[model samples]
Target: MTRSANEYLKRILLSPVYDVAVNSDLQKLDKLSASLGNDIWLKREDQQPVKSFKLRGAYNKICQLSDAQLAKGLVASSAGNHAQGVAYSAKKKGVKATIVMPATAPDIKVEAVRNFGGEFVDVVLHGTSFEQAKEEALRLSKEFGYTMVAPFDDEDVIVGQGTIARELLEQNPDLDTLFIAVGGGGLISGISVFLKQLKPDLKIIAVESDESACLQAAMLAGKPVPLEHVGIFADGVAVKIIGEEPFRLCQQYVDEVITVNTDEICAAIKDIFDDTRVIAEPAGALSIAGIRKYLRTNPMQGKKFGGILCGANINFHTLRYVSERCELGEQKEAVIAVKIPERKGAFRAFCELLGGRAITEFNYRYSTDREAHIFVGIKLREGRQELAQLTESLGSNGYNSFDLSENEMAKLHVRYMVGGRPPSLLNEKLFSFEFPEYPGALMKFLDTLGERWNITLFHYRNHGAAEGLVLAGFDIQDTERGEFDQHLAKLGYIYQEQTDNPAYKFFLSDVNGVFEK
Candidate 1:
């Protein structure tokens, strides 16, 4: 090991994190272990006072600060758990803290920061993301002469997070593999450094959300690089770039980095609840999701594997979306788009083909004169392979079907906008829109559009996040197209015209008949 690696390991061994952070449990997940045919364990960092592992690093760093630095107070930027950690640590140290958080952060987290710090911390809601909030925090630190505490990247913070590795080794020394979620790479970097030093053969699998796999991208580029965009469903780990120090450590010690989709993360959350009766945040559940994915292709029967349940600070409102996607994530639900004849008994015949299988969702609309398109979701009691066999059976029975389980557009938008375009609609345009989600936001949107143009089709669904997605169609004369464009521009909502989207053409367009086999 390098000198820096040795220093990190030593710091972890002597970390003062236990002053404020508990030694979280390392409990066996019996249900998951039995199902996967492996001995699964959960490192329950979610059980911490702040409900996240971030407290370990935050408290350790704060406790180590010089008396002069503490007297000047502290400043940091974070959207959720990190903010809470800093706030809690500052309160414990009797130091004033200023936390800059994204304005779009969940209300639960913003309130938690206030509760943790009480009179010792000031909460500043600024910008739309953590990066923007970080800039604001830096400015505040300069203005107030406060010490800036980084959420990750600093040696002290990395060493503090490494404490988990020490506990894991002491708790279960014979584990074959450990799955750790990566964000800015702090947790995994710290843990991998310590674990690899102690047990050279132990596999350290770094897990990340597919939408925000910055560490994976960094590894591929051989250096840290920023991602242009990242999904915020797993907002806790939605870092656009990995920290340089953490990246270096991960490169040297991490055995592999893998990404999991949103559905898989939700399913993992469900799995955790099934075993422990605790619901973990999407990022927290990512490690178990990675383990589940790995076991599918590489079944290691009876081998001991560990996963970190890094946090449990989930927004209560987001549970609806998590529950809805968990089934699909577990491959226990299959969404399909099908074409059927426009006769009276077509629906009955379609049900007969399903052969008593539970129908989760069914949406249909008559588009053309001779055929109709139906968006259906089937409950898969047998497993993922059953969907393929069912689709094949439908095709052999003369029903044209399209598997939409993996279609992003279908899952996010098209399924909700199933009504066919009207033949009488002339010069019609279809558009998908995204806007900040709040009460009456939809009404405000409609008011901005005015009553000038006829609305041909409209669809909206709330996923209980910061933003709302909408699909709409409008009928306007070519002469009035310029006015429509002006209205769209003035509305200030993010939108993309989807009149030519393939999914729309397949399911909603009047000109396109049932797809040819």
Candidate 2:
């Protein structure tokens, strides 16, 4: 059913969501503003009691329920935040509810649903995916006369999410552009409809994940369509299809829809942490990611921009993945595979040619007699342009290199597997060293010892810590061990010999593989 502009506005204004959800701050992101050359504000939806804006719509829908309908109980299907929203609302209303979550839902979220609802909500672990759980929820709703509280499809829920726009204008009326993350479209639909009607000149931009861009697909088709597959990274907004009503409202009011990749989302997460000290989930950071991408192409200045930090219910392990990709996403890091000469001082010369650029990672092994391919990760000062210039420098220096910055396979799997068995045994000794992370640390290490030894294997990675770590293998005769110890003592860096480390012997070293009777 199509809702009139005034109808949505009146409903949003009259929404009783304040009974539960707080008026989250529209805080200014000073750091982001200075960096982006724009006045940036983040609507703090993550401040909600359930740590997400989902509670607003869920509670609003539950409030508008008839007394008779409340007696029949409520049912809803969600994989994460929305389930918690419905559970929170149901518990507050003292009504019986059944939340159908996918069997594969994280244990933390499943327990949270039970904890939030207490005895009021019954949780059913249904199928492997949201679609399967949703099917089961629908069946229960039809068969047992339970009312379905959809995540984003219904009118009351849309009005609930729309109230964000009401508070946004009140907090910052001078905003030139607003960025809202889109999933099933209820959030953007409500915001766009209300904001566009009241402030016709206000630009409403919709942000979406590239993996499951249902709204973009809907816009192309002029209707809501199901995606063939949806990525689970941004699970909060991983709706396979755009809701029918949301598509209608968005088609009319949204100025533009932009999609961002996984790396950009990770970068946005880090940006939010840097400015607000809040680690947002992937979906929560979508608005900020979109804003950055839009400004990159449009290149505007001194304009006010607002984005919704929609949720902060992040799984802790996900932070590991976020940290690894954030630099690449911001174009501040580049990964490459380069073939350098296999000689005693080749690595030292290569480091000298880098002109003081810090390497984030390096991995190599003794492979060929003449040349060896090394995987390298370097921190960039000027993003892609700097990377291009570095590549040119490598080529000019007679080193063949392939940029693996954009290679998923290279980033995910191959980087860790860069070390393997050498073609033959070469009196090698493995050692791990720790040096204070400071200016010219790499050069200090190279100058201290590398020129005197033939380095057979090397692995180094920076983890943003106070110390830099390196695992190095050197081709040294048994008689040089005492001299090597003296050189190491003069270097004044902490070192540990790892020649007998079991894991290295089991996987990386071939001393056990080379057979001799």
Candidate with best TM-score? 1
Q: How many clashing residue pairs appear in each of the predictions shown?
A: 0, 0
Model 1 stretches with alpha carbons more than 4 Å out: 1-3, 425-458, 472-502, 514-517
In Å, residue 517's CA in model 1 sits off its true spot by: 8.1
What's the TM for model 1? Answer: 0.92
In candidate 2, residue 215 scores what lDDT?
Answer: 96
Q: lDDT (CA) for every model shown?
A: 0.88, 0.86
My TM-score estimates for the predictions, one after another, are 0.92, 0.81
Off by over 4 Å in 2: 420-517
State the TM-score for model 2.
0.81
State the lDDT of candidate 2 residue by residue for 369-480, as single tens digits: 8876577899999999998898899889997676777765456545776677777878888887776444576677777775788998777665433345678888889999
Candidate number achieving the greatest lDDT relative to the actual structure: 1
Poorest stretch of ten by lDDT in candidate 1 = 508-517
